[model samples]
Target: MVVVGSGNSGAQIAQELSRTHTVTVAQGRPQPALPQRLLGRDIFDWLSALGLLEVKAASPLGRALQRRDPVIGTNLRHLSRTRQLRLAPRIVGTAGRALITQDGGRLETESVLWATGFRPNYRWLAVDVLTDQGQPMHDGGVTRVPGVFFVGLPWQRTRNSALLGGVGQDAERLIDHHLSSPGPRRTP
Candidate 1:
């Protein structure tokens, strides 16, 4: 099997599939990964305790320090080191059942799994809420429009804002804003 992209999804899929089949992962660049736990505590706990998770996404220093999306909670490095998984360069194209890599490498496989991530598609929105780069213009998910909010957006508040386990804090903040704001309350 051939897996394209090496993010969390790709890495996890390759890891599981390799147990029953020969798997090759094609990645454009090296992925950043961190263990689930460090120093006898969950990494998320450390982030929360140190207040790193609350850093503003729009901070100039944060932008300067930003790199690649990190993959968490996986043993990808060990899998590669033990030869349980094979990693390769980016996939350029496919010919029949053969997958071609950027460096002229090819893999003949019966299945090709594409684990590339996605981007937000706001083209259907008629309002001018997007920036020139096609990203939403908002301060930590709250837009200029009254009562309008956004959540689960990458870097909405911090690096983990878009992660599944990370959206809760942002959601709670949005709920608080909604409840505290002056408005006409309609009782259901």
Candidate 2:
């Protein structure tokens, strides 16, 4: 099986399935662990620490941390390049076929898994707080998008809020603002 993307979710899923199948991870970046390390742990710890480690929203500094530290950025162990692992061009033209690259050769597979990660689907937002990529532009909980806010991500206003269990605080604050803020302004 082949897993596209290589984020935490994708890595976990790939590793889990690898025990039973010949799993391959197709990463856009040369390595996959960098993104994983952003959470602050080695692959062993990362995969096993699920729920045990605190997961949070991405804050300005946190997001910045991801850019600067990128813990797993250069580590490619998660993706073995040996015959066990192969580096192939990212699939584009179509998802109709499976492409493989190994020992300077190419082939195809019968099964594939696109674990390309999640793209925050914010299409339902009546308000604008997200970037073209659908990610919110905010520091802590303060949004550059005005009246808008974000929390529960990495560095969401507070350290704990980024933790999986801490998201409630961030949500509470945003909800409070939404409830207290005046209704939409009327046109002249």
Candidate 3:
């Protein structure tokens, strides 16, 4: 199988599939990776203790940190070293049943898994809260359009806002305000 991405999702999917099948991972670009643990502590524990995960998205420091887009934890490097997973360059196209790589090599695979990231789709929305870029125009999920709130958006309130473990905080903040605001309730 071919996994056409090397981010956390692709790396994880490749690792899982490697246990049963030969897997090749294709990277779109260079990425920095950090181990899940550091100095006998979970990396997220360190981030939480240092308040790095809570940094405001609009802050200069947060902007700088987001630019790195590091993969928090993965075993792909070790797996590659052990020959459990095969690494390849970006996949540019396909020639029939084979994948054409950026380096002009052709790889034949049974299937392909595209782990590329996603763009938010808000065309179904009927409100005016969308920005020119179609992102929800809000301050940490509090929209300028009343009663219209967003949660789980990338960096919605902090670096962890989009993570499942961290989204509860953003949700709590939005819920508290939403419940307190005197307005008609509309299902979201």
Candidate 4:
């Protein structure tokens, strides 16, 4: 079995699946914990107002930016300590085969999954308000392009948007507003 992420959720899944299947875990740069919202504020502020400070804020993973802590290490160890979860360096090339480092030698695996997580790909969008990387460049879902808004984007206005459960309401509001408003101008 191929597991795409190395986070808590992915780790748990791989462990369970490995009992009956050979599991390979794809790891990315270690992550900091999700932030706790300050009272009377939304995640946008927590992200924009504080910027680096927010990234440096503390959580279950310890202070956001600060390293040299055992929290992240312990978590990784707990998930990967098992023999079932083998640490493969990384897969190279696009040949549908994986090269994993094991016992000072390279081994091949059957399947692979990109557990790298979500990255915004908005290249098809007709607007320029999005960042170069396709993320909506906005504060609190308020875009530079008026009447064009973003919802369900990571940390869009609140921490809720980042979670699966929180995106529905934001999507509803954005869609409602977009449909209710007039269409774009046409050539006269």
Residue-level error in angstroms, candidate 4, position 102: 12
Error of 4 at 165 (Å): 4.0
Candidate 4 regions exceeding 4 Å error are 1-4, 30-76, 92-96, 100-105, 168-188
CA lDDT of each candidate?
0.81, 0.57, 0.87, 0.55
lDDT per residue as tens, model 2, 78-187: 44553345445455434346464433333366777777755457767877777788877676577755566666665555445655656787788777766676767333
Tens-digit per-residue lDDT, 1-188, candidate 4: 66666765665666677777777665554444343344766544555565432231224332323342112212444445665666454433443364543223344566666655566677787987877667778755667775767776655644455456667867776666666667673233
TM-score per candidate: 0.85, 0.55, 0.90, 0.56
Worst 10 residues of 2 by lDDT: 67-76
Q: Show the lowest summed lDDT stretch of 10 residues, model 1.
A: 61-70
Q: What is the lDDT of residue 9 in candidate 3?
A: 89
Least well predicted 10-residue stretch by lDDT in candidate 3: 75-84
- Per-prediction backbone clash count: 0, 13, 0, 2
State how far residue 84 of model 2 sits from its true place (Å): 5.4
Error of 4 at 84 (Å): 2.3
Alpha-carbon RMSD, candidate 3: 2.1
Candidate 3 lDDT for residue 139:
89
Candidate order (TM-score): 3, 1, 4, 2
